[model samples]
Each structure stands twice: as C-alpha cells, then as structure tokens.
Target: MLSREIINLQVGQAGNQVGESFWQDVLAEHGLDQAGIYHGTDPVQLQRVGVYFAEVNHAGSQSKYVPRSLQIDLEAGVCDRVRSGPMGGLFSPETYLHGESGAGNNWAKGFYTEGAELIDPILEVVRKQAEACDVLQGFQVIHSIGGGTGSGLGCLLLTKMREEFPDRMLATFSILPSPKVSETVVEPYNAMLSVHQLVETSDLTICIDNEALYDISIRALKVNSPNFKDLNGLISKVMCGVSTSLRFPGQLNGDLRKLGMNLIPFPRLHFLMPSYAPISDPKTQSYQGTSVPELVQALFDRRNLLVACDPRNGRYLTAATIFRGNVASREAEVAVRELQTRNSNQFVEWIPDNVSVTLVSVPPVGQKQAAVALSNSTSIQELFLRTHETFAAMYKRRAFLHWYTGEGMDVMEFSEAESNSQDLIAEYQQYQEARAGDEDEYDEEEAPSEGFSQ
Candidate 1:
C-alpha cells in the first residue's frame, strides 16, 4: 500500500494544547527531536512518517521532518504561546493563524463574525498543505465543542473542508463540555450548535468529555488535582493510538476511510466512544503487568472510557480494537473472540462479527504493550441527552439571547439547532431499540429482556 498523508488542524486553546502533546508523542515515536531533526538510528521509524509529517531537504543540510498541521484560533494568545514554546520550531511559521479580538466565548461571534472573516485564509493554507501530500487520505480536526473558537470556528473550517475536498475523509477529536469542568454558562448552547454542524460536516466524530478525563486521571493515574495538561495527555494517548495503524506497519492496516467504514454503521451516527488500555501512573509501572485479555477488558470498562457513558445502557454496533506491541496476532484474535463470546449480549446482533482487531508491531514509547478501542455503541446517546437537557433549560428562559442575536444570528437557528440535536438523540434511541432480523417488526413491547442471542 502507498503511504497516505493526513493534515491535522488544531483550533482554539484546548485543541492546540492537546495538539501540542500529540505532536510531542508523535515525534518521540518517530525518533524525531524537538527541532524536527532525526536523531535516532532506527530506519523503520521514518517508513510511514509521511502519514503526519513532511520530509524536507535543504540544499546542503540533512533531512528535517515538519508536521503537516495547522494551528488556528480566534484569538492570538494561544497561537503565540505555541510559537514560542519548546517545539515551536517544529512547525512552519505560516501554519499559525489567529485574530486580534477574542470570540468572548460567544458562538455567533466565532462562527458568523470573526471566524467567518478568517475562513478563506485558513482554507488557502489548508489547500497548500493538501497539495504537498503524495497521497492525502484525509484530515483530522482537534477542537472543543464548548467554546467560541473551537466550537464555532472549528465547525466553520470543517464545513469549508468538506466543500473543498468532498472525497477526502474528515475525522475529529472533539472535546465535549461537562458541567463539572465547564468554563462558561453557555457551553450547552455552544456544544449543541457544534453537534448540529458536525452531524453534517464530519465523517467521524470521536466524542470526549472533561468529566471522564478527570475520572481517569484521578482514579487510574492517581492525579489528586488534575489540570488541563493532565487531561490533554490522556487525550493525546488515544489520539496517537487511533492513528497507530496509519503511522506504522500493522497486520491489519486500515486507512481513515476504511477504519470509518468498519466502525460507522450509519451516516449521522458517526459519534464514537474511545477507551485506552493499561492506564496506570508511570510511578506504579513497575508493579503492573497486563495480558492481552486483561487489556481488552480494560478497553471495554466504563471507567476507561474517554466519554462519560455506560456501554451497558446501549448495545455495541461495531468496534475497532488496535493493539500495539509484541503481541502475536493469533493471541490477539483469540482474545477478542473470547471477549465477544463471553459478552455476546453487550453487542448488537444486527452486525455479526462486529468487533475488528489490528496489531501494530511497535508499542507506545514507554509501554511494553498498549491497546485502544473505538466503539460505536448506542449508549453514547446518554451524552447527547445530557447536552440537550442543559440546552433546553437555558433556552427556555432566553438567558443569553442578545449576545447571539446581536451578531446577526436569527433566533430560528437556535430552534433549528435544538431540533436537530433532539432528532439526533432520537435517531440513536431508534437504533438502540432495534433488534436483529426484526428491522420492520421491531415492536418495543416484545423486545427481548433476558438477553440477545449470539
């Protein structure tokens, strides 16, 4: 197979922070230093580096690898920080784009006013990046859904990308808001509007929430007072895990579209829950030893989920489990099969053999073995429901109507967004109630209660 390329777009403060950690990990894995210079002697490290990097050669200097990524924000503060950070030189200067005045946490300001003004310039930069790829597979956007820049401007860029490169795959590492760690009162409004746009724009949306991140850090990593950096580190691990097959030689190598095809059973139902295995504090690594089966089980545990939802509430439509390290393919396959057989009732019978596994020979930088799973489970509706309730509560009183309407946005867009979000929630509920071999005859009253057949 030809080496495929992926362009990453990081938006807003949260997105750029996660992107920073992501690039740091990616560089370490590919043996590239802080300055993007190759320092390791392993030739295999550079084999599939083109997936996220562009190899540049100067007239008389050795080769340097630059990330094919863009850092965008509605304010200049975040972008400026990244430019002066430790790995600042790793990126091309032109990739950073920002505006003078911040969006002030207003979705309309970012989407209709300030964000719209910068769309054409952002697209031009993206176009140049795409042109440089040998075989561009798709783009991955990293953003949050609870703020102005990430929620509003991020979706704007996604809309334009879909229009400009209709055929390429579009995936996102979307950060959803949680009341536990919210920075603004209108996060529900911002989040719902972003989801409405994501339903139409993105091919795959990997849902994440701060509540879950806090739980994992506190419980697993033993972080007493977890901060954004702690949360971003966990997200960066999953981000790298999801792209492992594309970044390295793997037994079951699948590109962005192929991976999406396997996991996404329906078009609008592309939101997924991600879980990572062998999650432990580095301080306790010496006492921990995990097997393939244990790791797979960990991947399904609700505590390990990056999104705050219980898989037990809804059946699994499909899943892709990517294992990294020296684990044998035969053992990994057996483990997944046994897991499916043991917990057959947890999965949907409509899609037989719904679980797929991939084995990458190289493990993460510090771990002996690791695993990541992306589950298209109906339980994720719980997340949307939470956002809907908050949005409805706030909309009922028209608490922050003036800020949005002042930016030339009509009140109908809010109604449409709310209605669209409700519809999305209903769609998930519809599929959750569906049973195998009974598409048309799915009578809710007669649904099985004991357990679904294998």
Candidate 2:
C-alpha cells in the first residue's frame, strides 16, 4: 500500500506560503488543529501522512505528523514566518530550506547559485523522507512559475529530482501569475523558463492561474482585497479534491499512477486545468444539494475553475472528473450521459470521447460533495497567450534584463525560452484549429492524442 508513496517538495516563498495554506486545509479536513491536537476522529479520516508525512515520535504515545515537504525560500522572512506561525510547531525545523539572500526576482540567481548551493542539504532531508516511504513513487513540487525562487529553483529541483531518481515520476502543482498585478517585471521570463523545464522534466503539471483565483476571491468569497491566505485556501480545496482518490481507496483511477494515465496521455501536453464545484469558502455557508446533472454542468464553468481558461473556444483533448463524498457511480454515469446526449460537451476531432468520469465516495472534511474536473484542454493556450504577450512586451523593451545577465546567465537563454513558449502556444493553437474547417475524421497529418476509458 505504501509502495506508491509521494514525496512532496514545496519550493520558494510562494511555494512555502501556499504549502502553509495547503497543510491548514488538510489539517482541518483531518480534524487536526493548529496545535496538532485532534479535534475529533468520528469515523477516522483518510490520512496521507504515512505516505507523504513522517511522524516525529514524542514521549511514548503522541507523535507529530510532519509532511515530507521541504519548504524552501531564497530569503528568510517567509520561511521564518512559517517557522514561528500558529502551525509552525506542526512542522520540523529541518524541513525549512533557506539561503542567505533573496533572488531579487531574478530567475538565474536561484537556478545557478542559490539552488545549486542548497541541493545537498535539501536532498538530505528528501532522502530521509524517501527512506520512510519504503517505496517512494515520486515528487509533487508546489510552486509558482512566475517567481524567482519557485520558477528558477523549482525548475532546478525538477531536473535534479529527475536525475537523482530517474525511475520515479515528477509532478508539479504550478500557480500561474496574475495578468494584471505582478511583483516582478520579469515574471514572464520566470514563467516561460519554468514552463520549458516543467514540460521537459515533469510527468504531469497541474496549473492554477492567479487571475481565476483573484476573481473567485472577489466574487465567491466577496473579499475586497484578497491576500495569499484566501487565494491559497481555494487552491488547497482543488488540490484536496484531486488528491482524495490518492489518499483514500477507490474503485479505479484514484492513485497517482492512474491519475497520470487519465490526465497525461501525451507526455508534452501535460498541463491540466482544474475546476471544482460546489465552491466552498468561509463566507459561503450552504451547498443547496445540487443535482448530479447540475453538478456535472457546473464542473465546466470557468467560474468554478482554479485556472482562467476559455472553454467556449478551446477543444478538450481529454478530461477526468472525480466525484467525491456520497456521489454514487450511477450518478456520475448519468450525469456524463446527460452532458453528452442532452447537452454539448465538446471534444477534439482526435478523441471525440475524451472525458473519463470516476466516482469515489469518500467522506468530506467540510463540504458535502465535490466534483473536480482535470481537463487537458486547448483552452490552456489562453494561459500561454497572457505570458507570451507580457513577456514579449517586457522582453522587447529589455526590462529587468540586467539582473539576469549579472547572475552570469547567457542572454540567449531568454530567446530559447521565448522560442519554446512560442512553440507551445502554436502547438495548442494548432490543436484548437485542427478541429475547425475539417471533418471529425482523423487526419494523417494531425497528431494522435492518446485516450483511455472510464
């Protein structure tokens, strides 16, 4: 049972901060408080701690469940805050990976110097956690692709993890930078470069855009100025939904191995846009008990999506919908039937039937039910559009170019990143356009997108 254990590695300020929120969500779900005290274990919740966490044995009985996660930051402030925060005691001091100075939003600084220096120490902790796993399947890197520490060092670790554990799988949960507000003028640089590494090294990378989260925060939570705390909570819910099948036993297609097969048929096109419903938050209270068909339909709504994607325009290459908490197998099948038979659920010409629905009846920690959709759709092209445009605008003007050059990184790296990102945008665009002006029949020239059954 522990053979497929996942080793999570949370990198950078964005990663650690998000990691904090994620842990908070998991703790709440498991009825564990900030003090690590058990609130209640009514039916006994599904704890992934044994797989992704290690217990620090106390006197004779009580033990602290510390995640295999290694929280890293180029600077001290974020890591320091987590080390002293309310939930700080729940974590081990050794898990906080740090360096002398911040990356100043420069990707090269983290990639070349900082990440290179911390590799040995970080791997040591990872080794200890892996040894506990008995059979370490792979890693889940939680980080933003638009920041220095997350983007540069996150990519560095992705490559390093691949080299260190060649047989294991590497998956990333990446946060896309908001289009409007950004701290780094060179966010486009960081995002594109990391995107290249993610495509190359990782088996699957689930992307959640900040634009969608910010909008959800304002509309769903009704927060005037939502901070990372609020946004991270929303992200954590989606993560929980995606991971429920992994944490708890289900019929099929629940574990990390099957999730990869369901989400990523094509190795390169591994970007999955996650959408979950019904949206739950602090301000929001009741779940009106939506019908199965409505639940299925709502799964396609961009409003419920963790990432901002245009579903109306783009084609779905493949999709996997996970229904948890009291959802029956018959319910899921009927819902998918209604969508396909009664309503329009668009799919690409290559795979007309790409949506694989799975029903897992795991008890929810808070919400009564959740429908999480992991879709490999061409709408992801829209995300690349935002990064590409902003990157082009900033790159053409040579904005913040000196910081990278000063770090001893070659200037041509930027061009390479642009070229790779541009290729991605074009590839998705081709996938989207191929469906148009052509019959549903597969063209020999068109790339064959892999598919699987429910």
User: How close is every model to the real structure, measured as TM-score?
Assistant: 0.96, 0.91
lDDT of 1 by residue, 327-422 (tens): 988787788877776777777766777888888988999999999999999999999999999999989999898999999999999899999988
Whole-model lDDT for model 1 versus the true structure?
A: 0.91
Please give the lDDT score at residue 328 for candidate 1.
83
Q: Candidate 1, residue 413: CA error in Å?
A: 1.0
Q: Report the Cα lDDT for candidate 2.
A: 0.77
Instruction: Please list the C-alpha lDDT of all candidates, in the order they appear.
Output: 0.91, 0.77
Model 1 regions more than 4 Å off: 439-454
RMSD of each: 2.9, 3.3
Residue lDDT tens for model 2, 401-437 = 8888888888788898888888888888777766533
Candidate 2, which ten residues in sequence have the lowest lDDT sum?
444-453
